[model samples]
Target: MTKKNIILVVVAFLLLSVVASGCSKKDSTDAEVPAEQQVFEETAEDPDIAEEPVEIITGAPLEEPLAEPEVDEIEEEEPASEGSKAPEEQSTSLGDQPVPQEAPVQITELPVESQSAEPEKPSGPSIQLIKTNGETFYMSLDDMKDRSELHFSGSFYWLNSFGSTGHTDFKGVKLWTLLEAMEIVDSSSSRVKVIASDGYSMDFDISQIKRMDYIDETNQDVKLPIIIAWEENGEAYDPSEGAPFKLVVGQKEPGDINKPQWVSNIEKIIVE
Candidate 1:
């Protein structure tokens, strides 16, 4: 044969061998990859296919969660019914003595001014009445008697808010008598309010009179004597001197013996 014809034959054989190799590979793949495996691979490659996630639990069935202990529910208490009886008040007794019930006190307001009508202007030194026992009395020096010409003569000083009166002597009508004349007693549901003509006033406890310091004169230590003094230094109190009448307490002093409980220009005293 000619060399060109030989070369052409060799090239043809090489092409045929390549074609045979491809056919053999196809047949082997079809036989080895079953239809199921081929379908699975196709489905895995498809974008529309969704695969469920698998959880890898490597432990024994989790010990069944321990049962929770039962808890007792607390019940709420109901309010007392309207018809239920109220508990009786407890009382204390001393020895075998019977316990006493507290006495009812009559209601009263202080400064007694509110309990009465407007007062008439005083033509002279006067005392306006404020009675807790439903009684009233108005009086001037003419109507009041000096039950005691209380003489506070000594080196006694009168300390007051404005200024101090040096050791001086004071003469005045006894206040206890005045209170007695008005029927004030410890049991009365009232306190004493001394009001000045100019509206200045102070309260005096009626119970103070029962105190030894007030009843015992030697008790110079006694709560200083309180008074409705019309005179000081033997002279009547002129307007310049807290005139007409002035309510004062204390006999001597030093230490917060401060400002006398003196409400000057005495006009009225109310018991309330």
Candidate 2:
């Protein structure tokens, strides 16, 4: 045999010897560990398994659980004896004594002056007549009605300021008759004035009072009388339509606006 081949054989044999020794040592270490210790170490190292911590006992064990306490029974009250009275009866019992009662209260009435009363109605004269001689006379509706002989009933046509025309049936005394009755018409008394409650007034000549001349619907000369009226169409005037007295006159001519000469709610008549 050659020397180089002999040296290669020796080196290969030593390498095989070292490998065999390592495998034998690992087997011997695994065999020395317990099976449970091996399993615990494997479980700790595994990512999927969670390891349980060891619990060490440090003091005495807990005593047995305490028992619940027992409940006590309630005692019943004893009944009253037949010889003793009840509390309500003992408080109410009073022999041979009368009970007292409270007295009633009295109320006072209010005086008659303190009570409310109805308001009195207003009173005023119906009409007043003043003469040029400074003689004044106040009259009422009853006084005027007493002179029934001078009353006249007629129908007349009239024209108002608005160009409206109307015909009314009137019952009243004539202006001339009223004037003559009061001796108001005289030669020196050239004019007469009629006034309303609202302060409206109109003046008239004595000639007009004696004769109120007008042209009829046919445009012919006709003479009509002026009157102080209290009723129209046989009915007394309403308060809204010039109550008590109204001055009315027929149209002076066919187209004369005669309403301006008329007066409503006549309160005064003066002859001057």
Candidate 3:
């Protein structure tokens, strides 16, 4: 071969050898890097690739920013309540309010009356007494013998379907005395009703309650009074004329028979 051709061939061979070695070295380095590592290298070199936060949303609308749970402001301490001290006082709160306490009442000490363990048997005729609370009490004439006295005059008219025939005089005890004896607790002005075994009943008006000694200074009787007559004309009434018991109302004159003044066979008395 010529000298020029030989020089050109040698230079070409050296260039090819250098290019082949460089290519082999680049392939080996690239193969050593993992795919994930390649992505990290690219991301590190590229400033534009930033990590952005990811969020998953559901169908329900976000509740008005979750209105941060309300917190009550602490309150200033309050003054001590009645009948309570500051340090020893108990505190209780319902929601935002505190309970109030009432002051204890001061009462005067009084003597208590003595009572019998067992009720005493009545000494007189049997009579049923009903109080306002539907309580029933049994009593007798002798049971009320020691009670307060009530002296009043009255007249009884022989009552029938047609009308009154004649009249008789009477004097006896006030029903108020019997009710008081029953230990009835109610208004004194409450009505008093008397019922008889024959189904006859009479309601006495408390507004009419009056006694001869209680006459007002105005020359007018304050009220009308009711009485249970056990005696007539200084003696007990005859059986034919309602014996043993008869209800009579106070009347100053015999002409007062027009009013309901008589109730016989009285077996029950009610206080209301």
Candidate 4:
């Protein structure tokens, strides 16, 4: 070979060696890194990657503080009440409201009697019956007790139809006793009048409840065995049930033409 040709061949051999060495180094470096690690490294260096620098503490480090849960903030509102009236022209907030005042009752001079009069009977229950004659009695309910003053009087159950034959025991004071006490001047007519609460009236004949002439020669018990009941079935008499006073008369015998005649609200007793 010529000297010039040999020199050119040597130069090409050195250039080829240099390129082969560089390729070998690159291959070794690529083989050392895993595909996943290579991708992570590239993304970490990229500007668009969502990465934030974390501060690292050296030595005996402190524990990371626990993050607090976020909560929504709420605002308090005041109540709008009737007593909190707003000023006429302005938007008055609750905080700017003025306290209300109560009106004072006016006091005027008046006669002493007018001020202290027994506050009038403001319309309620009042005694319905008026006293006419004989003896007037006022009984207090607050002091009533059992077996208290047995007053009995009655009339025929069917007055018009029975005449004296249809005569029945009525409600009122006992005829014999009342007559005996009133020192009755006359009982010859054998007539008695009983008034009821509903303004009902009935006439009673003494002959129907005639003096019982049984075993006892005098026969005082049978003659005046009448009852003035204030109650029935262990309870006070209802206003509609003829209570406060009721008269029940029982004759000596069941067939004695006197059974049961209920008369209530006895206003007066006339022995004629």
* Best model number under lDDT: 2
Give the better candidate number (2 or 3) by TM-score.
2
| Every model's TM-score | 0.44, 0.50, 0.44, 0.31
Q: What is the lDDT, from 0 to 100, of the residue 67 in candidate 1?
A: 90
Candidate 2 wrong stretches, greater than 4 Å? 1-125, 212-215, 218-223, 239-243
In model 2, the Cα lDDT at residue 70 comes to 78
Please give, for residues 11-55, the per-residue lDDT of candidate 3 as tens digits: 999999999999999999998777666667777777776364224
* lDDT, model 2, position 140: 62
Error of 4 at 153 (Å): 14
Quick one: ranking by lDDT, best first?
2, 3, 1, 4
**Deviation in angstroms for 65 in model 3?**
41
* C-alpha lDDT of candidate 1 relative to the true structure: 0.61
lDDT of each model, Cα atoms only? 0.61, 0.75, 0.62, 0.50
Model 2 gets an lDDT of 0.75
Put down candidate 2 lDDT per residue, 1-272, tens digits, no spaces: 79999999999999999999999999999988876676678777885763565343534466989888876776775777866745442343357444444465877778989865433322533667778987776656665677887777777777888988777788888878887886766778888899998899999887877885654554355556898888888888775555489898886656878878778899888989
Tens digit of per-residue lDDT, candidate 1, span 85-192: 443443445565555567779976677656665447467656776677646566676454344444333223555566544455566655665666557544654577
- Clash pairs detected, candidate 2: none
